[model samples]
Target: MTASPNRGLALTVGAILAIWGILGFFFAGEGGHAFFGNEGGYLWGVFLVNPALCLVWTLLAAAMLIGGLGTTIGSRNLNLLAGVVLLVLALYGLLFMNTSANVFALNAVDNGFNAIVGFVLLLTALAADRENLRALRADRDDLDALRAEAAHG
Candidate 1:
C-alpha cells in the first residue's frame, strides 16, 4: 500500500519529541538542570521540565506516530487533530510567555521552538491532504479518459 504523504515526517517528529521528553527525565531528580540550560529547576532552558511534562510529550508523540502509521479514517483524523493541537499550544506559549501565570516556564526560546515544530506539523498535514486530493482527481480523470476512448473506438 502507498504510504501517507506525511507519514515519514510524522514519525520523525514523534521520535524526536519522545526522545526529548525521555531525556528530560534524566535530570528529574534533585539537582537536575534543563537539557540545554538551567531554567525552572530543569536541565533544559524550557519551563519546569518535570515528569509530568515528559509524560505529556510521550503521549502526544505516541499519538502522532501511531496515527501516521495506521490507515484507518480515525488515524487520519487523529493526525490532523494532533497537528492542530500542537499549533494551538505553540501559540499559547508565545502569547503568554511573560504572563505571571505562565507556569509552563515557556520562554522565548521554548516558544520559538514550539512554533517551529507546530508549523512543520501543520504544513505536513496540509501537504498530505493536498496530495491525496490530487491523486483522487487524477484517478477520476484517468477513468473518464478511458471511458471516452472506449466509447469512441
Candidate 2:
C-alpha cells in the first residue's frame, strides 16, 4: 500500500538527516588533520584553522536533524534547532576560515550546501506538521458546532 503523505514526508526528512550525519562524520575526522593544520584541540593545518569546532557543530546538527524524526508528534523544535546550528556552522566557516589556500575545497562546498539544506529541512518539518494542525482545527470547529447545537436544543 502507498504510504500516507505525512509518513512519506517524515521518511524523506529522516533520510536526509541520516545521509547528512554520515557525511558529517567523515568530514569531521578528515577536517581536523587536513584543514585546521593541527592534530589536537587546536588546528595545525591550513591557516591554523580549527576543525574541532566543525565537529561540534556537525554533531549538534546531527542531533537536531535526528530530533526532526519526532516532528509528527509536535517535535519540530529539534529540526528548527538543527537549522540554527547548521546556519551557525556555515557562518563560522565563512567568517573565520581562510579560503585563500584551503586544502579540501570540498569542505567549503559542503559548508555552503549544508547551510541551504538546513533551512530546507526546517521548512519541510513545518510542512509535515500542517496536516496535523488542520486536523486539530477541524476538531475544534466540530466541538464548537456541537456546543452551539446543544444551546439551541
The TM-score leader among the candidates is 1
Clashes in each model (backbone N, CA, C under 3 Å)? 7, 7
lDDT (0-100) at residue 95 of candidate 1?
76
Clashing pairs in 2: 36-44, 36-45, 37-44, 37-45, 38-43, 38-44, 38-45
How would you encode candidate 1's per-residue C-alpha lDDT over 41-102 as one tens digit per residue? Answer: 45465545545455666787888678667653434466567667767766776676667544
Q: Given candidate 1, what's the lDDT at residue 36?
A: 32
Candidate 2 on 47-82: residue-level lDDT in tens?
Answer: 122344445544654554444444344345555555
Find the number of clashing residue pairs for candidate 2: 7
C-alpha displacement of 41 in model 1, angstroms?
A: 3.9
lDDT of each: 0.64, 0.51
In model 1, the worst 10-residue window by lDDT is 33-42
TM-score of each: 0.66, 0.50
